[model samples]
Target: MSSVPITKHGAGLLKEELQRLKTKERPAVINAIAEARAHGDLSENADYDAAKERQGFIEGRIADLEGKLGAALIIDPTTLDADGRVVFAATVDLEDLESGEKVTYQIVGTDEADIKHAKVSVTSPIARAIIGKAAGDVVEVQAPSGGREYEILEVRYV
Candidate 1:
């Protein structure tokens, strides 16, 4: 599989989640399954069925996380030498040309993108438009509503 880019922080979070799943959740579910099995007839046991379903979901998530970590190319933003240009994992400050509103976003991988936290996926329109662009550059992004322009005010690698 191709190597997927992930911020160092993002990779650490994923690793923490994997550890929790293995050490805590996985064991808890196993115990729950065992308790449900001891309840008697497996055919009519709703607890058993529910436990099995939960176990399936947990296992699937574990596999998915493992695959992602295995293919991850962790990049530390602080170590990036992009010279003030907008690149993967760089936090960029921008101003909306039309509304005069300002916003900041950190370009991250899809798995770490969270709009509520101002983290955007690299594949997002704005991130794509600003990639490799330095501060003071004007970028036009094609949004679902309409095309919008933003002026890059600053780029930070932290």
Candidate 2:
């Protein structure tokens, strides 16, 4: 499989979730399943059905997380030496030319993108447009509504 890029912080979060699922959630669901099985009458056991469904979901998630971790290329933004160009895991400040609004975004992998936190997926239009662009560069992004322009203000590794 190809290596998937994930920020160091994002990798940490994934590891935490994997640990919780294995240590806490997995065991809890196993116990619940056992308790439901003890009730007997599998055909009519609602608890057994629910517990099984949850177990399936938990197992699937565990597999997914494991795969991601295995193929992950964890990048620490602070250690990036990409000069002033915007790249994955780089935090960038930009000014909207039309609206005159200033905003900041950290370019991250798809799984780690959180709009509320101003972290954008590298595949996002704005991020793609600005990638490899240095400060003071003007980029035009094709948005769903229309094309929009932004001026790159600053790029930081940290």
By TM-score, how accurate is candidate 1? 0.99
Judge candidate 2 at residue 100 and give its lDDT: 99
Which residue runs does candidate 1 get wrong by more than 4 Å? none
Alpha-carbon local distance difference test for all models: 0.96, 0.97
Question: Which pairs clash in the backbone of model 2?
Answer: none
User: Residue 109 deviation, candidate 1, in Å?
Assistant: 0.3
Cα lDDT tens digits, model 2, 21-107, are 999999999999999999999999999999999999999999999999999999999999998999999999999999999999999
TM-score of each: 0.99, 0.99
